[model samples]
Target: MSAHTTASGSTWAPSSRKPPLRARLLRASWRGLPAKRHDIGWEPGLVVPAADGSPLVTDHYFPRAEGDFPTLLVRSPYGRGLPWSPMYGVLFAEQGFHVVLQSCRGTGGSGGTFHLWRNESSDAQATVAWLREQPWFDGKLGTVGPSYLGYVQWALAREAPPELKAMAVQVGLHDPYALFYEDGALRLDNSLAVGAGMTYQHQGTGPFLRAMLRLRRRVRTAVGTRPLRDGYAPALGGGIPWLDEVLAHPDARDAYWQGADPGEAAARRTVPTSLVTGWHDALVDQAFVQYARLRAAGCETALLVGPWDHTSALQQGWPEVFTESLAWLRAHLCADPSGLRPTDVRIHVGGGQGTWRDLDAWPGQPAVTSWFPASGGYLTRQPPTDSAPLASFRYDPADPTPSVGGPLLSGAAGSRDNTALEAREDVLTFTGPPLSEPVEVVGPVSAHLRVHADTGYADVFTRLCDVDPQGRSVNVCDGLGRLRPQDGRTARLTVPMSATAHRFAAGHRIRWQISGGAHPRYAPHPGTDAARVDATEFTPVRLTLHADSALLLPQGAEDGQEVTAAP
Candidate 1:
């Protein structure tokens, strides 16, 4: 350790002589982080015993001049190197908290096989037990991390000890089933991406990058395989039995997925928790579910939503995320609330000009507005008087509609120009007239449709897009719903288009896109009752949309005025 003098006239020690320069650079990259209060020391390769007496590799980061600071536990399946080491271990430790960055079982040289969510709860309890025995343990603890790390925090909170004072779950996942399946359809791309990541990410960066590239190159072949379960094997660098198991069990009620969801953890704990997520994150809905559960259980919780996808939330949005997280931890653990925000909900509104807005709670009392899809590809505010068909399209499972953009785990995630996607024959679009004034939507978005499908077994994919004056249609938020045999005889269904806080600029058109499936993003419905993984035959389904269908949006104005659609 080397002692360094700060501009504030205090002497602090860096974990290693070389880390100060790297730490300084890392701190510089993130804008507006609170000033470093102490220097940190890193202890690597400490072995913590798991519930089954297995050795779990862990790293401890502590302030050299610490005086009973709260400890922050970050457990991850990803390797404990690069970003994890400097980001969580060094940064938070420098901010006057001890950070225990540990690798979950079978990852980063930890013992035992990784059984996904099955082992997290026991492992978390064991780690805390170990923490209690440490000489420097102050009995005040907090938990923070992103993605899988966030999931571990939830697992720990399920039976959190009194010492666990605060938690910050950023872009986290609580339900493994929800992460892999949506509306009865398997999220093919997400499953493959997660498969590759969990398998190779812990090995090192190089292997993970190579595996991701390999998956990208072979994704089409994998997605188009005759037996869908066997197709992803090649892309994932040989067979991942767990991936196959996940695909085989699409129903969340299956025994295989039982106990996978730790969502009940939120309702059972009253810890001051801060939730962070992006509007376009793959797990945005899960975050909302967590918020709802916490609120329902009367827990102290806060939410921060940005205009970012899953990965970008940590990259581009780190400044805001870090600031919010640090404040929450400080307020709860250090008994300091000076840096906390006045409101519990903060969101970044996306549009021509992106701006941040704060509210007492999320989706607080927004007015529900309806826009009907009329014939001739027009979206109108008035409902149709006649019960006639508005549009029709044929969906071929062999040539499923390609996904353009929205929440996905891979690099191809986020909003994209949808000019080519809209031109596809398998897709139907209804365009609203240009808006004379900006129409802001700030809550849950849903599309209620009355449709008939030639094949009883089908899927309905709905998307909300913003068509700019330049004719660029970029997806805002979208969702998919699986239709059953009973639905073949004209079904009335509501497709949850997730949620969003977006502003349609003046002159921009609101477009509602309907498609049978978004291939790869979702496993294309085989147009039969058989499970997609077992279906060897494919069928084409003809879908007819009724004009009575409407897109429901929770619209709100900044000035408390009514927002009307253009004539």
Candidate 2:
């Protein structure tokens, strides 16, 4: 069972007599995928069966590509085989898989418009239907992908593809806007970097992402390493349009984004799933939401949250993630297990330094709770005396607070923004004394406060930071609440910050900053000037962090399950 071979492997032969027209057309369908060439041999070409033209599909088939292997289906947005993702397709090919490198629909050779994650569910379902009929396919399929690609698997899983046996969704998105555009602000930088990387790959950069190799024997340095001159022009063209689309849409509710939301109904089920994540990952919260929701809904799932980011795992080699993944595939698809661990949640914990542990569920159990905040700087049980003046800070749209961390996508995406950028009068900061001891705050951190605007609409955003012993402020988490509380400012509201399991070292302090914008994800209030404006306008006015205003985090727990703190 270990050495698998495709039914059409060496047996595929050209016949002496001319083939029938329908047979020839099926073989040469201008529809499915084109034949591919790989070093091992002529790579099995595309495998799309005739379907409604709407089922645009692109894929690479390996005839016995994996030695005695089950199929490995990777629907990637990043052109497959790019060294950036560590030669994934080529490696799987070497592993004896009838590996299929799908270019999704609008991405590679497949024809269609790219709309992020929404339309992919139907596409994935149709793709499975085609692959199952392939002579080389074993009627079993498993999917793997990261980031946008990971989100694709999630959308597909919602409907539970009949042929889809399992999946490894790495850094996938549960909520598109939450992951990409937070609080209405544009995180232009990181999103651009991702776009650029994918662009470089799509144009077949093998020749150019590697033009430097041509210099080896000559011993002379290449005159230039520019992207265009190196053959990355096509990739650039491919990515630039997508990038432009991102910038043009400032509102999360834009029609363009609605079609890209993977987390909607498409990702609600508990398909047998394995998730990979990290404590430092800006995308960690989304994974947490997915894992918790899916598990609660009764899906057999496994989580491996290492202490890494978007790219670090591939470079450093977390064998556990990969080995366990293959084991999951084997158990579900190939029906094999060579000595695997079965615990559901595998976490690399921080706070008391770092280590690994496994639990049956996430936030696996109960946790401690503490509410810390104030009209001024304080983390006490007592509310600030009403006699004391309420805290106030100015928020100028021209000088809006730049973003930092916590489920971000732009340069100023997820992490805490430069305190220096925010300290410029637009942000209000309250700092407390260093912790008396190591304090583990591991759950959803939230803020409840009273806010006001000179006009009818306003938005309030909150960020939590860990001030080090040296007095530097590092962001931990943040949340946003947009309000049209003006003509009738609503009563005090509690905004929800994303959840996290973090530690405040004995010597570290905590800081809370409240501002008005994160942008592109959460629309910034454009100030109360425009009466007919939506909630995205900025509204300037005095803000009050009521005497009872505070930030609450669930505390120390054996398992990292989430807890909604009650006052």
The C-alpha lDDT values of all candidates are 0.86, 0.57
List TM-score per model, in order. Answer: 0.94, 0.75
lDDT of 1 at 516: 97
Q: All candidates: CA RMSD in angstroms?
A: 4.3, 10.2
374-490: candidate 2 lDDT, tens digit per residue = 644566655555633356666655344545555543223334435574555667777777788887766567887766654545668887787888777777777787665443653
- Which candidate has the top score in lDDT? 1
Residue 263 Cα positional deviation in candidate 2, in Å, after optimal superposition = 4.6
lDDT string for model 1 (154-209, tens) is 88888888889999999999999999999889898899889998999999879988
Native-vs-model 1 lDDT?
A: 0.86
Candidate 2: regions farther than 4 A off: 1-68, 84-87, 180-201, 204-269, 280-282, 311-320, 337-342, 385-389, 410-423, 518-524, 529-541, 559-567
Backbone clash pairs in model 1 (N, Cα, C under 3 Å; residues 3+ apart or in different chains), count = 0
